[model samples]
Target: MKLRTWGFYFAEAWRGVVGNGLMSFASASTVALSLVALAAIVILGANLEHMTRMLEAQVQVVGYLKPDFDRRWSDLLVQKVRAIPHVTDVRFVTKEEALDRLRSELGPDSVLLQAAEDTSNPLPDTIEVWVDKPSQIPGVVRAMRESVTSLDSVDYQQEVVSRLAALTRAVRLAGAGFIALLLLAALFIIANTIRLTVFARRREIGIMKLVGATNGFIRWPFLLEGMLLGFVGSALAAAAAWAGYRWLAAQVALGLPFMPILRPDRVLLPLSEALVAFGVALGGAGSLLSLRRFLRV
Candidate 1:
């Protein structure tokens, strides 16, 4: 398409919006609201998944050695765990360390425990294994159980690991479903709004048809109009989402210092770009679909 022709289409599209001001505003608002909802869900899910992965990194398998197990075999087992793929860190905790930990945890009862320390601290020497990936847990556990020379029992937060995995899957499924519903709603609203625009200008379209205007020529203006509205609406939604995320981050920092809650700049920027592209495509598709039935030429 030539620059002049493109300009003409743009002009006509803008004119259409100006001619039907309230209808156009309503359509744009519909698209904006839908995009905003979709973006919010996506941002929330992304940040949460990031935080959960961080939490998962803190999860570890504590392999307690038998009381009679040799210290050499325990050291060997710790080395083997450290060599496992995705294993981040493995530290051997002696029975003494465990006893000390227990004592500290008991607080006021520490003095009594110290007095009876000769009763044989039943705590076993253990190895705490941490991995980079959550999926590595089962394999690491199996390897330690089978390949390790000494391990009485492995104690890990199985419930937490399982629930986190399940939660990640649920979040993905729910995010997809929410986005689909919002896009569908946006399409319907844009189609109805554009349908009215086409109806109000039915006579003008008939005249253009008589003047030898092709289908492509008639379609371009509506498509461009829809795309323009989508772009503007998406920009507004992105701005609102960013501001909301900033506020959320501040609140998290103030109230939950220990919790993992970083600003979502990396996640949100790409998502905002995606939202703009998706919104434009949806609007153009909806406008074209609506205009076709009414144009009939």
Candidate 2:
């Protein structure tokens, strides 16, 4: 493809867009709306995935010891627990450390903290256990109870882990289906718009064929036109998505500072590039599909 040939394709594509301004606007607007929903889903899925990772990193099992439990076996117990499957390591939290933690949780002026300071600490020794994965919690907890004696209780956030896993799967599956539907609708509208443009230019197409122009030559301008339509829509969608996500992130930061969400600056650049590429691909696909029947001559 020479520069002049490319220039001609761009010129013709531009002419098509300008000649059928209403139809072009309709196609682009529909594409933008469809892509905006896709952007929302992508951003949401990203944040959910980030949160899941954070939780996974922090997830651990804690075992409380009975007050009468012997402290002499602490090192031996650590060794026995480390030998358990999926148990990475274990640590002993003495009553003093546990009291300090309690105070931290209850705050400096807390009545409970003042009383604990004045009276002998009744906080039990705690065993902090780390596992390789969240799924191993149940089995590991059971093993802990069986292997260790005078165990007060075994505690882990297995429910939280399970719920987050379920939610992430559901969001991704639903989002994927919805995105597919939106893309199909966008393709249908763009194809119809391109088909109309092709119909109006049928005479020119025939003349080009008569002059020995290849089907490729007749197709290039319409292909470019379709792509241009997608380009405009995707750009608009990306801009809107970036702005919306940035504002939402800021609001989340102010209202729910503990919540973990990706910064727009980190997320938007790649997201926008992906949307533009996806839009252009869809445009090319719509152009190809629409022209398949019309190119028989």
lDDT of 1 by residue, 1-297 (tens): 789999999988898788888878877887888888887777766766776676677647888887788776666677788888778899988999988877775664566676659688877888898877666788888888887756789877656766866776787788789778878888887887778778877887888899999888888888888887788778888888888888888888778766676566876788889989987998898898798777775
Residue 135 of model 2, lDDT score: 92
TM-score of candidate 1 relative to the true fold? 0.76
Per-candidate TM-score against the hidden true structure? 0.76, 0.87
Q: What is the Cα-based TM-score of model 2?
A: 0.87
**Candidate 1 Cα misplacement greater than 4 A, ranges:** 63-77, 80-89, 93-126, 131-155
Top candidate on TM-score is 2
Give every collision pair in model 1.
Answer: none
Error of 1 at 176 (Å): 2.4
Candidate 2, residues 128-179: lDDT per residue as tens digits? 8988999998999999999998789988987886788788889989999998
Q: Poorest 10 consecutive residues of model 1 by lDDT?
A: 107-116
Model 1 scores what on Cα lDDT?
Answer: 0.80
